[model samples]
Target chain A: MVRQKVLLIKVGELKDLFRKLFVVILFLTAFLFIMLSRFDSVAIEALNKVVIKVTGPVMQVVELPARVIHHVWTYFYDISHIYAENQLLRDENKQMMILQNKVRTLEVENQLLSRLLNYVPPAEASFMSAQVVAESGDKFTHLLLIYVGNEAVKKGQIVMGDESVIGRIDTVSPPYAKVILITDINSKIPVVVERTRVRGILSGNNKDLPQLIFMRSTTDVQEGDIVVTSGVGGMFPAGLPIGFIGSINGNRVEVEPMADLSRVEYVRIVDYGLAPDAELSVDFVESEQNAR
Target chain B: MRDNWRENLKLFAVHRIPLIATLMMVFLFFMPINSVQINYFRPVVGIICVYYWSLTRGYIFGFFSAFLVGLIIDIYSSLPVGVNVMIMMLLVWTTDWLRKYFSMSSFGVNWLAFAIICTAFLLLKWAFLSLYFHHLLPLAGSGLGLLSTVMFYPLIAYINALIARKFLPQERIDE
Candidate 1:
C-alpha cells in the first residue's frame, strides 16, 4: 500500500512538472510571435490576410443577430420620433430654399471671378460606399472592418461617415478592408483650424477627443473652432471636415470627431488619387517602425 | 464495433465541451454592437471563460485550448498577433496554480479571486500594449472594461457551470 501511494505521488509530481514546462514553452512561443509581428514580415502579413479572409465570413454570420437588433431598434426609434422629425425637416427645408437661392447667386459670381482669374479647379475625389461589418470591439484599439465587394479599394483611402471623416483604410484584402479610426492611438492626420488656418497634426490617444499637436506657439486657437483636413500629406483632400475644437488648454487642444464613430454602419471610402499605392503604405510602415 | 465507435465519439464530443464553449465566448466578444453605451461596457469574456474552465477542469481545458483561444482573439483583434495569446496563457497558468485552493471554494470566493486576477491581467495587457506602441496608454478604458467583466462574472460563471454539469463527466468535474 505504501509503495502504491509513493508511486501515485511521483506521478502527480511528474504531471505538475509537465504542466509548468508547457506553460513556459507557451510563454516563449507567445514572445516569439510578438517579435515576429513587430517586424511585420511577409509571412506574418500573409498569415494575417489568410486569417482575416477565413474569419471575415464567420464574423458576418455572428453579427446577424446584432444587425437585426439594431435594425429593429432603429425602426422603433424612428417611429417614435417621426412626427417631430417631419416638423423639423419642414422648418429646415424652408431655410434651405433661401440658402439655395443665395448659393446659386454666389455660384454665378464665383464662376465669373474664377474666369477672370483663370483659377484651376481641384481634382475631383472618387468614392465608394461599403457597409461596416465588424469592429475591434475592445478598448485597447479602435478599428472597423468594412465589406468591400470586388471593388479596387486601396490602402490610405479616407473613410467618411455621413458628414465627416471617420478613419482610413489601414489594410485591404479583397471583399474586406480594415479601417483605423481617427480615435485610435496610431492615427495621425494633418488638420487646420478653419477660422485660423492654424495647421497642426491631430494625434489620437485612444480617447473620445484627439489632441492637436505641432502648431506654432504663437498661433491662435480657440474652443469651438472648426477643424478640417489641410491636404498637406496628400493622403486626405483639403477642406474635408474633421471636427471642431472641443477644448483648448494652454497648449493642449482636443478636437471631437464630427462623426459618431460608435454608431457608424456605413462609410464612404474616398480616393483622392494623389499618392501612388505603395507610397502611403511605405510611409505608414516606416512611421510605425520609427515609433517602435 | 459500430456501437463502440459511437460511444467513443460521444466521449470525445463531451470532452471538448469546455474548449468549444470558450471559443464561442471569444466570438461573442467581437460581436458588433452599435450602441455607444453597450460598447463602452464590453467585458473580457475570453478571460472569464479561461479562468472558470481552468479552475474547474484544468485537465480537460488545457494549455493548448487556452493558446488557441488567445490565437483566435489575436487574429480577430487589431492588436499585435501575440498579445492575447500571452495574456490567455498567463491566465491559464495562474488559475492552474491556484486551482487547489479555490476549486472547492464557494462561488463568492471564486469570484473574488477572479476579480483580483482579472485586474492583474488587464494591467499586464496594458503594459504589453504600451510597450508595443512605445508609449503609455490611457488606463481609464481598461478600468471600465475590468468593471464590466467583474460585474458580469456571475452570469458567465453560471452558464459555464451549467455546461460543465450537463456535458462534462461527473468524475472529471469532481476532480
Candidate 2:
C-alpha cells in the first residue's frame, strides 16, 4: 500500500510521466550505445555515418553565405585582375621558367648522387581532385569538408593542393572527408628546409601561417627557402613541398604555405608509409660500397 | 487538433513577419560582401533558433536538434567533425538546466543565464582548440573577437525573444 502510494505521488508531478521516463530511458540507451563499443568498430562507424547523414543538409544551409561570398569573389577577380595581372603574371612566368630550369637540373644531380649513394628515393604521392562541400568552424577549430574523390583517401593521409602541402585527412565517410587545415594550432609536422636542409620542428600558429620552432640558432635556413616534409618521423613522405619560409629570426622561422588554402578545390593524397627496415638503411653507405 | 491548427496559423503569421524581416536583413548584409572583411557570424541565427525551440518544447528539441544546429554552425564556419556539435550539446543542456529557475517569463534573469552559457561556450571552444593544437592561438586578436560576440548576444537574444513571444506559445494572462 505504501509503495503504491509513493509511485502514484511521484508520477503525478511529471506530466505524461511514463512517456517522459521512457524518453529519458531511450536517451540513456543511446548514450550507452555510443560508449559501449569494445573494438566494435562497425557499430561506431554506422553511428558516425548516421550522424553525418543527418547533419549533412544542415551544414549545407550554414555554408550558403560562404558560397555566395566565393561566387561574388570570382566576379571581382575576373574584373579587377584580367588585364594588368596578365602582364605581371607573364613577367613572373618568365622568371619562374628560368628558376624552374635551374631547379630541374639540381633535381637530376641530386637523384644521381642519391642513386650513387644507394639512398632510397622519396615515395611518389598520388593526387585526388575534390570539391569543397562546406566550410565550418568556430573561433578555435576550423575544418573543411571535401567531397570524396575516386581515389580512396584515409585518415592521417597528407592532402596537397597546387603541388604544395595543404593538410591531412582528419576523418572519412564514403563520399566525404573532413580536412583539418595546417593553420590550426593543433597541427604539427617534422620539416626540413629544402635550400639549407636544416631539420627542425614545424607547427601551426592558428594564424595565417605556421612557425618553425626550436631550431638551432646556427641552423642553415633562410627566407625564401622551401619547407618540405623531413620524413624523419614517418608522418609524411619526404620531398612533399609544404610551404616557403616568409620570415626567419635567430632560431625561429615563419612560413607562408604554397597552397592557397582559401581556394583549394582539389588535393592529392599519396599512399605513403614508413619503409621497412628504414633504420637499417640509415646511411646506405655499406649498400653503395657493395654496389661499387 | 482543430484549436492547435488555429493557434499554429496565428503563430505562423506572427512569426513569419519577423523571420522575413530578419532574412531580409541577412540577405542585404550578405549581398554586398565583396572584398570587405566584415565580421558577420552566421551561426548565431541557428543557435538562437535552437534555444527558442528548446525552451518552448524541450522534449521535442532533444539531442538531435542541438546536434543539427551545431552541424549547421560547422557547415557555415568550416570546422572539422562538427566540433560545434559538442559545444551546442553543452549549451542546450545548460540552458535546459537554468530554465528550471528562469523561463522566458523571467525576462532579464533568463537572458543573464543565457549570456553566461554563451560566454562559457566560447571559452570552452577556445580551450578545446588549444588543447587539440597544444598551444594558445593568439587570443588577443581572437579573444577580442570573442568579447564582441558577447556584444551581439544581447541583441540576438532580444530579437529571438521577440520572435518567440510572437510564435509557439506565450505566457498567458488568462492561464
Candidate 3:
C-alpha cells in the first residue's frame, strides 16, 4: 500500500512537471517559427507546401456542398436574367463585329509601323487555368488557395481574371498554390497610367481598392485613367490590364480593379519567361497574321 | 471481454463527437465560398466548441489536444505556424480554469463570461497579428465578427445541449 501510494505521488508530480515543460516547449517552438518566417526560411516554405498538399483535397471535399449551392443559386439567378442578357449579347455581338474589323486594321497598321520602326513586342504569356480551392480564414489578410502546385507552377507567376491582372502566386506546393490578391497589404505591383504613361507602385492596404503610390508629383495622373502592368520587375508581363483610377486623395490614388475579385471562380496562371531585367524586344513579338 | 470492449466503444463515441464536430467546423471555415468581406467576419467556432464542451459536459480539453487542434487550424487558415497554436492554448487554458465558476453560474451569467472572453480573444488576436506583422491591422471587420460570434453563442449552445442530451450520459451533465 505504501509503495503504491509513493508511486502515485511520483506520477502526479511528473505530470505537473510535464505540463509545465510542455507549455514552455510549445511556446518556444511557436516563437521560433515566427522569427524564422521573418528570414523566409526554405524549410518553412516546404512545410507550408506539405501542409497545403495534404489539406487541399480535404478542403475541396468540404467546399463541394457550398460550391454546389452557390452554382444552384447562380443558375436560378441567371435564368431570371437570361432573356435580357441574351438580347444584350445580341446587340453587343453586332457592335463587336464592327470593333473586330477596326481592330484588324489597327493590328495591320501597328505591325507595319512596328516593322518600320524595328520595335520589339513582348512575348505573349501562356496560361494554365486553375480553380480556386480554398481560402485563408483570417480577417486581416487576403489570400486564396488554388488547386495547382509548384510542380507545374512557380511562385511570382501572374494570376489573371479574364484580361485583368488580379494577383500573383505567392507560394506553391505539390497539389496547391496560394495567390496573394492585389488588395492584400503585402502586394506591390509596378503599374503605369496607360494614358499619361506615368509610372507608380500599386500598393494594397487590405481594402477593395489598392492605392497607386510613389508617383512623381509632376506626373500627370488623372482620375478614370486606365492602369496596366509596367513590366518593371519582369514578374508580370507588360500591358496586362490592372485597374482604373477610382479616387485621388491628395497624393494617394485608389485603383478599382476591373476583375470582380469576390466573384472570380477560376484564375489563369501565366508565365512570362523573360529575364528579370529583360526589356521588350522584336524577337519576343509574334504576329498571328504572319503565323497564319 | 466483449462487454468491456463495447462499453469502451460507447464511451469513445460519446466523447469523440464534440471534437469531431469542432474539426468539421474548422473545415467549413476553410471552404472557398466566403467572400473576402464575409471571410473577415467568421466566428471563432473552435472557441465555441471548447467553451460548450468544457461548460456542460465537463470535458476539459488538455493543453496538448488544444495545441494539436490549433496547429490544424493554423495549417487550414494559412497562418504563421504557431499563431493559432498560442491562441488555442490560451482559450483552452482559460476555459479550463473557469470551468468551475461556469458550472455554478446561471446560463446568462456563463454567456456573459463567454462574451467577455471572446472579446478578449479577438483583441489578443489583433494585437498578436499587429505585433507579428509590425503594422496596424484594421479592426472594424474583426469588431463586426465579434458581434456576430457573440450573437451566435445561444444557437451554438442550444445545438451543443441537444448533442449532449442525445449522445452523452447523464453522469457527465450532473458532474
Top candidate by TM-score: 1
Candidate 1 docking DockQ: 0.67
Clashes of 1: 0
Worst 10 residues of 2 chain A by lDDT: A276-285
Ranking by DockQ: 1, 3, 2
Candidate 3 lDDT over residue span A1-292, tens digit each: 9999999999999988997898788878777776766676576777787876776677677767888998899899999999999999999999999999999999999999999999998777677999887666666677787887444787778899887999987777767888888988877888889998997778887778898876765248778889999877666777889999999878889999999887677999887775432122112211211433
Q: lDDT (0-100) at residue A196 of candidate 2?
A: 78
lDDT of 2 by residue, A1-292 (tens): 9999999888876656765675466455444443433335455545555655665554456557767787798889788978998898999999999999999999999989998999976555555677667543344544567777445676777777778778777667756677777776546766788877886666767676788865545357768889898776556777789889988766668988887666665566656654322222223323433544
Put the candidates in TM-score order, highest first. Answer: 1, 3, 2
Model 1: residues >4 Å from true position, as ranges? A1-25, A113-120, A276-292, B1-13, B173-175
Candidate 1: C-alpha lDDT: 0.84
lDDT of 2 by residue, B12-121 (tens): 56544433433333222222222212322423444454555566456545555566555444443444334566666666677677667666476566556556665677
Better structure of 1 and 3 per lDDT: 1
TM-scores for the candidates: 0.88, 0.66, 0.87
Q: Which stretches of candidate 3 lie over 4 Å from their true place?
A: A149-151, A275-292, B1-16, B34-40, B54-60, B162-175
User: Cα lDDT of all candidates, in order?
Assistant: 0.84, 0.60, 0.76
